[model samples]
Target: MGGVYVLGGDWLPDAGNRKVLTELPPQLAEARVCGLMQTRRREWDGAVVRDVLSERDARLVLTIPLSTQERRDSLYWMAEKRGRFTVRSCYRELVGEYEGDGWMGWTKRLLANAEALRNRWVECSRICPLCDEEEETSVHVFFTCRVAQRCWAKVRVEFAGDVRQSIQTAFQYMFSVMDADRLGFALIVCWSLWQCRNGAVWRGEAVTED
Candidate 1:
């Protein structure tokens, strides 16, 4: 894929042109003739510059020293210190930065939201929004509810043992048996079911099977 050229600071929109920096603005173009355009911000003071460009982009720019010598531009990996690309480096680049505390954090959030912990604190109804026939416990919302069961039934995978246990155990068992792609599809179904439940509760919409 062709690499993207990101201009720093707030310049005028390039009208979809990537070479906007090469064709500098009239003010900057004139300044470039006087060597003033090459001036670095005093506030930066040898520190990394920040603004429109990302941290990676800023670091990449710094690596290219200002030189009078003209040379053919070449692309290099920005993730690695030596600008060499590797499978691991590419994988890390694709994944980007880690956010939250992974599955454990997600489980806690799911429990808190499904169990209506906030509602309990305020002395409100803890009824399941989708079914309205039982308390909105984590297990009911994620596994046992009529809507949740329908979502799970749509998946092609079969459970060897009982998956009616807690959410964590159920997921653990499911993950152990399924491949990565299958697990991902199952997770998407779970998320979609949750979204549908929220829609029913907040917007009075009917649960959709598809």
Candidate 2:
């Protein structure tokens, strides 16, 4: 409990050391996520949180006021029972995935990267069901999964952006540079990626078509 406190991330400012969070390895990322969950559990183990997430994000996370009901949200998402994306949760963060109004659908879809399942502490393969090669992180589902790669390939989008970055940052960079029309089209492809991922994971459907 050695940090500042706030409630929710709607008004939270950006991290000062975002590179640290982005550069952390997947295993350490899980640790950072667990540290955030300490807040939800009404236990702010500030040492572990700051040690893992660096000072800036830890302070940003600590700002959120704990609730008696144990709410579920993230300060910055890991692949599983981690914090939600705090710095950038809006679809506009992905460079205007929505125009006049924001995309509530896409915001919720942020938590559905594993085709509607997210592991907590259980030791299981985090492998992508569609690819069977990489972890089923949101980045993988949308940009780097084998099926996802094919979908991007169909549209002649060969680059998968940067898999090392969080899905939000990667999407922002990938979409923001495109023209308005391409950006709109990319949003559709993004939604298709989600739908096809669900179809393949939940319905036992083949998903090679773009």
- Which structure among the candidates has the greatest lDDT? 2
Q: Tens-digit lDDT track for model 1 on 1-210?
A: 012323332222221221223434455443211132234431221342334234543444444443354444455455587768554454333223334764454455443454556645755467887777888877788788877777778876455567757776776665577776666666666655665676676557686546
Estimate TM-scores for all models: 0.45, 0.42
What does candidate 2's lDDT look like per residue over 1-210, in tens digits? 223122222324342222233246555433423345554467666777566555666786666565566455534443123555322332344333454454344544455444335554445447776777788888777776777767777777544436326665656555556665555556667766765665666556676654
Please give the RMSD of candidate 1 to the true structure.
12.9
Off by over 4 Å in 1: 1-105, 111-114, 118-120, 208-210
Q: Report the Cα lDDT for residue 201, model 2.
A: 66
| Prediction-by-prediction clash tally | 0, 7
**lDDT (CA) for every model shown?**
0.52, 0.54
